[model samples]
Target: MKSQMLPTIFIMTLALSVCGVYSGKVLVFPIDGSHWINMNILIKELYSRGHTVTVFRSSGSWYIKESSPHYNSITVEDVAGGFDEDFLKMLISRIIQIQADGKSSWKRLQVEWELMKLGPVMTQMEINVLAKLLDDHKLMQSLRDAKYDLVLADPVGASGGIIAHYLNLPLVFNVRWTVHSEGHFAIAPSPMSYVPMPMFELADKMSFLERVSNVFFFAFYEFQAQFLIRPLWATFTNKYFGPDVDYFQLIQGADIWLMRVDFVFEFPRPTMPNVVYMGGFQCKPAKPLPQDLEDFVQSSGEHGVVIMSLGTLVSELPRRVVEEMAAAFAQLPQKVIMRYTGEKPSTLGNNTLLVEWLPQNDLLGHSKTRAFVAHGGTNGVQEAIYHGVPILGVPLMFDQPDNLSRMRAKGAAKVMDIFSVNRDTFLQALQEVLHEPFYRENMQRLSRLHRDQPMQPLDRALFWIEFVMRNKGAAHLRTESYKMPWYSYHSVDVILFLLAVLATFMASFVFGIKFLCTKVCCKHKSKLE
Candidate 1:
């Protein structure tokens, strides 16, 4: 009876606290495909908590039309054509082509940066699609009539900002990338002392060379954003929002920023009032695995199971690498369930099970699951950490190297370069992570920290969302530093002014001393004569 009464009382109290503060009409614009799940969890939770939610997203997004009564998903095609699909197909092709040419990680990094240099081209493509949406007379009318409480947008692309401006709504950015430069610039101080740039794969601590690379990469990011791509974003903004609007200034209109990063998995850094961390925010209880998968895991005996997946970004690994991993799995005692989108490279070993896709969270949650082999994507890494599963990270591109570096630094994972993957090396990595107690212990610690938040991420997000609605965009939360120019915000201008003053004073004193010394010497000479 006491247990029953306690839960009942808790529920009632929670309900009362959320009455007016948790419900509002929210417009969500998140990146489609793999990144969608991050915000999808928040959206579902919001709807369950009685918020009227509208999502402007891709047609192929996970959210279907019949998912909920409180939600309305506006497909990108209803306004613009099916550009998301086209973009993703192009992206995949480019990645595959680059992988073919890039024989080493350094070469791959250069290829990725080369793609980043095509920012203007990408920006123009986004602006073209979004412009069509804005020009849709009926869609614009409906959006204006909706009287949305707030706009939620992903900062990866410029379309969200343009849409938010067109609707005359307050904007909030949801960043899937842990170290998004633009998102960091929008909300608060991202000092180089702690903040890392994405272009260079850097961790929190840096040697002299790493720091030099960090600064250089930051200059590169600035070049892409300001000099190379700024003109494209500027043209779009001017064409739509008027010539008076500067892209940088327009981007600063974001009221709040929610980053899917936490101190547990990342290096601890200072964050602003408007900046919120939601790492492992997408983690939820796993549903039951299929009977087939369950049987496979249970059949592994006392050796446990290992899950290997490269995530959605990589459709398939190179056939040679796939065959090598398969051979390594054959030599292991543990049963492995791997996600493979391509044909089997070689005859499958009795210890391995190949599936097109598996319920990743469900597999991770299983007690029999002892290890993970992945490409070190943030979501995959976070999920592995959430489940307390040690990982053998085979990083390929983007933030994968940095994520794996941090994982290795934290003692939760081992990293093997994709280029260096042979049967011997792969098997050695697997043996180390599975047999080592330190790796499992570190993973367990990470899991505990990720879940030990004061309030759940969903509730925190809802609280801020409704807080913005109730306060008419929560302008109070915006830091004053957002208004400061780059030089003033970083104190570069003040430092220069102080240096100039000191130089002037020193010059004046030196002149005075020289003049007095000459006069004294002349007077002494005259007296001697």
Candidate 2:
């Protein structure tokens, strides 16, 4: 049976590849976030093939000008300058900091920020971005005229979905699995029983207490988004999507959610067919390391080198953190290449090299690189996995802990809490991953699985993208469970029905017992008489 399946699958794949250029006009509307890195890969591949790809992005977004006949871009003037990229980073930082402080005043402030300031400001930002896309009447008409096959929607925000629906285009989502929100969960199967919410960073198998907390985690998430955030955003959303449309409903519009995750790392969870796993699609062939970096690693002798980075979102860390990190590296025999964006630390050891930015993937791919010590971001973690480098994860906030947890679970990494980090603990973590053989072996095993796929991640992504195009967004693959209400999804009605029947049977049995007792007592009285 397995042998037959392989031959048949190969035949079908061949058919898909040679299906005679069912080329498409794909509209790419990637959100201006960490998502852009992968989208850049997707765009390039689509154009490299025969497909006509057009992107609605800002002026300064990473793209070559008129790169090819098939490649094109449309820059929205207002979107280019309107949204403040730093504002979001600052807001998230402030929120996380306040949550850490846990003062009554801070709690009140967080509430006010979320209820009054955060929602309104974020809503206006989305409004500005989308309005700019639609504001030009002529541009809107031209987009209508182009007859796009599908809209590649970023699953993070509502603007992309709104635009796609307005244009009557089928929407396919490229999602990050670790997003773990009420809105994103709606895209596919996310049973509250086992699927750990990204916010909690709990393992797939939870303790009784953890499960209890997980339930509340979900409840609050759903409550906050549906009740608090939606009302505020809806005013702006309704203005654009028309008065009748529900803001929360926009997330459900995705015909497919191409999640950036693999089951090998994540815990086993139920997923529907349309929730396609296209994880590590961003793993590309590593370019050669710069000569200077190569020379630096070569100077490490037999100790090799370890790379450190906190990724873009949390590049500028606290001074103490940097000081401790430097102290930790100073103790290690291995040389370190630390990528930091803020002011360079003064505690520089001769073995430590600090750069504002580094080619992380290139460094990880290097043969002598011993370990990675950094903020546990999905991108960085995936890159490390691809390069077979073990990690010393310094998890800060959001999905970082969860990403780190997965790495730790895989036996390829160890997690040190950023909040509770000390020189002793930090240095030990670095040493353990560097010195251990199992860490390297486990990572190598994962790397083999990642690369050993029948087709590469990029090819698979392209195939699915074109498949969606060819199959009109592949609506047939969508699960009916998406359309189900919360009650129906969990089968509340079925439970109620069974409970009612059990109650009826119990009542009848009690009545029968009482009648038999009465008959026996009457017979006893007759015998006495």
Candidate 3:
């Protein structure tokens, strides 16, 4: 038996070795911070699969490192400043302050305006980087010479799509958001009647008033994209590409969009063929925790532990909010582990442990973890769903509220407005999630459903990426509707033409009947005479 097994093992090993040799070179343009976390997972996977990876990072990148064993880094010097931690922290604080003014229309607009300010800044930064990259003759020549197989990018910024177009490389997007709108809105048919726009925090099912609001929100974003955002990229687009080139069109024309979400987390809506769902692709079974953390988990005993983290961008909340949260955590019987960089809250209990960083995935996967208190980032929410941990969400900004809304709709989470959250309210929400069996049960069921797929989300994403590279592009899968003008794509012209033909036929028939009647009447009159 041993001799027979050795031969089989050798055969299998040889086959695996042969298969691994067919690797392609991938050029990555990733967004910094939490977005980088998702992109980095793919890069690591590609590296493990024996593919060569090269990362393009701005000189002032926040989270993206200059050195990584998984990929080579090409730093874009003096191009433009990438999003750093301090800038994000300040933005978050301002948004929070604005939100405290209540939910009146004027207040909402104020918040929107605050958020809208980022559009020009980020767009301009990306355009500057694109221009700088293109202007450098040596760099451009080297890029062309290297002949990368494809460009994998997060399209929150347009630089990647523009560069991909410039190089004529096959493009794959690791996307949730695009420069203009949500990823689906960029390519898929999103009927505003049901498909809620991002930031609205509405669910798939909506009331009549909600639908109206959805439409209004849709229009607002459309206006922002067209009038405000699109024009910023025009000068660069015209200079490098042609004047006829549309920047948004280049984004829509990507070969594949590896959307970082799945049906489990996303509302049921129309999606494109090339749009692959890879929700929780960064998730994996938790490894053993660090010894100190393990001791804490062991100390929880039967009561279990509650873990909290606001993700990479905004670790520290306002001092008052932190105090409120700390007070709430103090009331819980379960031990708490929270990630905070702010001053330690005076109300904080001995049961709660504050750390500068926590291993979120490992903590969530622990059997002792009772619930998660989070700010409703996609990565954190998906991880909770993946690990079967229910969430108590304090959605701060951006898609956070919307994400929490989905979880709440699914009965896997309970959410409260961060501005409205007090010690009592926070404790109540947390207690409900901790005490309710349905929360855990629903999340576990979702976890099972998410896990029951034939292949891992990451594996699916990798296969499609390789599929694109092997074929030079996934043009067959991508819809050519993006290339068509709006009237043509929507078939408005065809509908009008059909209507005109029908009208012509009707008019001809009426005229013919009238002429025949007139002739018959005249003949009758002549016979009578």
Top candidate, metric TM-score: 3
lDDT of 3 by residue, 312-340 (tens): 77756667778888999999899999998
Between candidates 1 and 2, which one is better according to lDDT?
Answer: 1
* Deviation (Å) of 378 in candidate 3: 0.6
lDDT for each candidate structure: 0.76, 0.75, 0.89
lDDT of 1 by residue, 1-529 (tens): 8988998999999988877454678888777666676777777777887888897765544423425565787765533344455566566656656665436767667676767755666566667667777778898899889888888877777666667777778887778442126356456556675567653557778787777777787777777677777787777777777887766564567777777877888776667777777777777677788998898999999999999998875677667778888999999999999898888868469999998888998899998999999888888898888889999998766667778888888989998766557899888889999998999999999899888879987677767766777777756777666567779987999999999999999998999999999999999999999
Candidate 2 lDDT, 1-529, residue by residue in tens: 9988999999999988878678799988776667777777788788878788887776544333424464577876555344446665776677556544333555644644553456545566666777777778899999999999989867666766777888888887777731126234776567667888774568888888998988887887667677656776678766776777765565675777777887766777777677777778887667888899889999999999989998776657666767777888888889999988877777668899999889998898888899998788888998998889998888766567778888787888888766556678888888788888989999999888887777776777778888888877777777656456778888898899889999999999999999999999999999999
lDDT computed for candidate 2 = 0.75
Off by over 4 Å in 2: 1-19, 58-71, 77-83, 92-120, 131-136, 177-184, 236-244, 501-529
Candidate 1 residue runs with Cα over 4 Å from true position:
1-22, 58-70, 76-83, 100-106, 178-182, 514-529
Model 3, runs deviating above 4 Å: 1-16, 79-82, 101-104, 520-529
Candidate 1 has an lDDT of 0.76
Clash counts per candidate, in order, are 0, 0, 0
| TM-score-superior candidate, 1 or 3 | 3
